[model samples]
Target: MEVVSSVRTPLITGGKTVGDVTQDICVRVEAKPPKSWFLAMAISLTFLFVGLYAVFTTAWEGIGVWGLNKTVGWAWDITNFVWWVGIGHAGTLISAILLLFRQKWRMSINRAAEAMTIFAVICALFFPFIHMGRLWLGFYWVMPLPNTFGSLWVNFNSPLLWDVFAISTYFTVSLVFWYIGLIPDFATIRDRAKNKVSAVIYGALSFGWVGSAKDWSRYESVSLILAGLATPLVLSVHTIVSFDFATSIIPGWHTTIFPPYFVSGAVFSGFAMVLTLLLITRKVYKLEDYISVQHIEFMNIIIIVTGSIVGIAYLTELFIAWYSGVPAEQYAFLNRATGPYWWAYATMMTCNVVTPQLFWFKKIRTSLWATFFLSIIVNIGMWFERFVIIVTSLHRDFLPSSWAMFYPTFYDVGDYLFTFGIFFTFFFLFAKFFPVINMAEVKSIIKSTSTSDKALK
Candidate 1:
C-alpha cells in the first residue's frame, strides 16, 4: 500500500535488541539530568515568569490591557487558542488513527506525540479562560448550573459553549489515551529502578502492569478500544472548534468548508510541531537510530499532503465567496490578500502553500535540517491563518466607522509566550520522567524496524 513510502527505509537504525530499547529509553529517566537540559529549563522558566507577570497585569486590570478594540475584539488570544488546539491534533492522529491502520512506523513516535497532545490542549484551554477577564470569579457561569441571580441558564447555542464542550472532552480523552500508553513503559521503568523512591513512584504509575500473557491480552483490548474511541475525537473535537467560526455570520468565517479544512490544517500543524520537538529530542538524546531520518522523511511527506490541502482550501474559500456574489465575503478574502494585513496573507501563502511543495523532492524531505525549518514555518503560517480569518474579517466592516486595525499589546504577545513557557517546561519535565519512546511497543516491533536489507526482505 506504500502507507508512508514506496522505497522502504529502516524505522530504527541500530541493531538493537529488546533490552537495548529498554536501556536506551529508561536511562533518560534514571540518569542525572544533563546540564544542557537544566540550561534549557532555565530559559523556559524565564519565559514562564515573564508571562506570569503579563497574566497578573491582565487580571489586575482587565482584558483592556490587550490591543482588542470594539472592531477587532477577537485577535491574538483567539488566534492563539485555535492555533494551539490545532497544534495538538497530530498526537492523537499519530497515536490513534495510525494505530488503527496498524502502521509499524508509529511506534517510536507515538508516546511523545501523545504527550504533546495533552500539553498542547492544556495550553489551548488557557486562552478562553483568561480571555473571560473574570473567569476566576464566575467561570462556573459557563456551565449549565442554575443561577440565583437571574433567569439565565447559559446560552446552549453559543459557539463558546461548544468550545467548552469540545476542549473538555478532547482534553479528557487524550489524557486517558496518553496515560494508558505510558503504563507499560512505566512498568518497565519500575522494574529497573534501583532506588526505592524511584521504584515506588514508577510502581504506582505502572498500575501493577506485570506484562503477563493475560495482561498483554487485556492491554491490547483496552488500547484498541481506546483507539476506537479516540479516532472519532480526532475528527469531532476540531470540527467543533471550527464551529466557533463556521457558525458565525462574519464574512471570512461563514463557510461550509471549515470543518474538513480545519481538520486537515490541524493535522498539518500538529505533525509539524511533533517534528520540531522530535528533531531536537533526537539530537539531544542521541536517538537517531530510533527516530531515524526515515521517520523525519515520513512526517515531511505528511506535511506535504496536509499543506497542499490547506492551500486548496485557501483558494476554495476565495472562489466560493466570489462565485456566490457576496460582496462582504468577496471583500473579506480580497482584503486578506491585498489590504492592510496583506503581508500576513502573503506570509501565510508562502509558508503554508509554497514552502511545503519543496518536499515533493525526496532530498528536502529527508534532510533533517530542512524538515525542522519547514515544520516551524508551517506552524507560523497556520497561526497567521487563524489570525487572518479572525482579525482581517473583523478589522474592517460594512460600516467604515467600525473599521480599525488590530495591534497586539505586550499582553497579547506575553500571553502567547506564556503558552510556550508552559509547553516547553512541561515537555522537559515529561522527557526527564517518562520514556519519550514507547519501549514495550518498540520491542514488540524490534524485528520489523531493522536496519539491514536482509531483515527487510
Candidate 2:
C-alpha cells in the first residue's frame, strides 16, 4: 500500500522529534537575548523615539504640523493605515483559511504569522486615533456610547464608522485566535522551565493547559470554531476598508472593483511581510528545520498570484475610468500616471506589478536572499500603492483652482516610522520570549513523511 502525505516534503526537517521540538523552542525563550536581538531592538527603539517625538510635535502643534491642505487631507497617515492593515491579512489567511483546508504545512509557521497579524492590526489602529488630531476626543467620540454631549452619536451611515467596527472586530478575533493557539505551546514551555520564575510565568500564560485527551479534544474543537469565525474577517475587514474609498464620491476613490482589488492587494502585501519576517526569524533563531525553503517558495507563489491580480486591478481601474467616460474619473487615472506624483505611481507599478513576476522563475522563488529582498520590495510597492491611491487622487481634484501637491513633513515621515518601530519591537520580543513556531501543531505532522522521502526513516 502506498501512503500519501499531504505536504510534498516533511515540514520539520533535520529529523526532529517531539522532545527536540520542546528543547529547541524552550531554550530560545529561557536563554538571554542574543546580541543580534539587542542590535535589532536598539534600532527599533531609536525609530520608536523618533516616532514619539513626531507624535508629540503633531499633538502639540496640530495636524498642520504635517502636510495637509484642502486638496490633500488624507495623505501619509491614511496611506500608512491602509497599508499596515492590508499587510495584516496574510496572518489571518494562514491561520484560519489554511487550517480550514487542513494544510499541514501551516502548522510550522502559523504561530508567528498570527502574532504578526495582531501586531499589524495594533499598528494600523494607531493611525485613526493619531490622525484625529484631538486624540482624546476622537478616540472616545468614535465609540457609540451615550455621553454628556447629548445626541452626539457616531454616524452609522459612514464607512469610516464601518472601518471602526470592522478593524476592531478583526483585531479582537485575531487576538483571541492567537492566544488560544498559544495555550498548548505555553504548556510545553511551562513543563520544560528550569527556574521558578520561568515556570510561574509560563503556567500563568498556559491557563492550566494540560496535555490530556480531553483538553486536546476541547482545544481542537475551539480552534475550528475560531477559524470558522476568523475566515470571514480575512475577507470582510479589507472589503470594509475598501469601502472607505468605494463609498466616497471622489473620482479615484469611488469604484465597484475597490473591494476585490483592495482584498487582493492586502493579501499580496501580507504574504510579503510574512516572508520578510519568517526568513529573518528562521535564520536568527536557527529555525531552518521548521521554516523551510519549501515554505518560502509556497508563499512566494502566493505573492506572484496576488501581485498579478493587483496588476490586473491597476489596469482595470484605468480601463474602467476610460470606459466610464467620466471626466473626473479619467483625469484621476491620467493624473496619477502623469501628474507631479508620477514618480510614486511609477514606483508602485514597478515594485508591485513588475517585481513579483520574478518569482515566476523557480530559481528566484527558491533563493533565500532573492526571496527576502523581493519581499521587502513588495511591501515598499504596496505602501506606494496606497500613497498613489490617496495622495494622487486628492492632490489634483475636479477644480483646478483647488489643486495642490502633498509634501511630507519630517513629522509625516516620522509618524510612519513609528508604526515600524512598534511592529518590530513587539515582533522581536515575541521571538525572544515565546515559541515563534507552533510546536504542538508541528509535532503532529513530524512523521507524515512523503512517499519517496527518506528523512523520516
Could you say which candidate leads in TM-score? 2
lDDT agreement with native, every candidate? 0.90, 0.90
TM-score of 2: 0.97
Give me the runs in candidate 1 sitting further than 4 Å from their true place.
Answer: 1-8, 149-151, 451-457
lDDT of 2 by residue, 166-204 (tens): 999999999999999999999989988898998999999
CA shift of 401, model 2, Å:
0.9
Task: State which candidate has the highest lDDT.
Answer: 2
Worst 10 residues of 2 by lDDT: 448-457
Measured by C-alpha RMSD in angstroms, how accurate is candidate 1? 2.7
What would the per-residue lDDT of candidate 1 be over residues 1-457, giving only the tens digit for each residue? 2133347665777777778899999999999988889998999999999998998898889999999998888999999999999999999999999999998789989999989988999999999989988858546767787778444798988887988887898899989888888899999999999999999999999999988999899889988999999999889988999999999899999999999999999999999999999998898899988998878888888899999999999999989989999889889989999999999999999999999999999989989888989999999999999998899999998799989999899999998998899999999999898999999889877765565333444
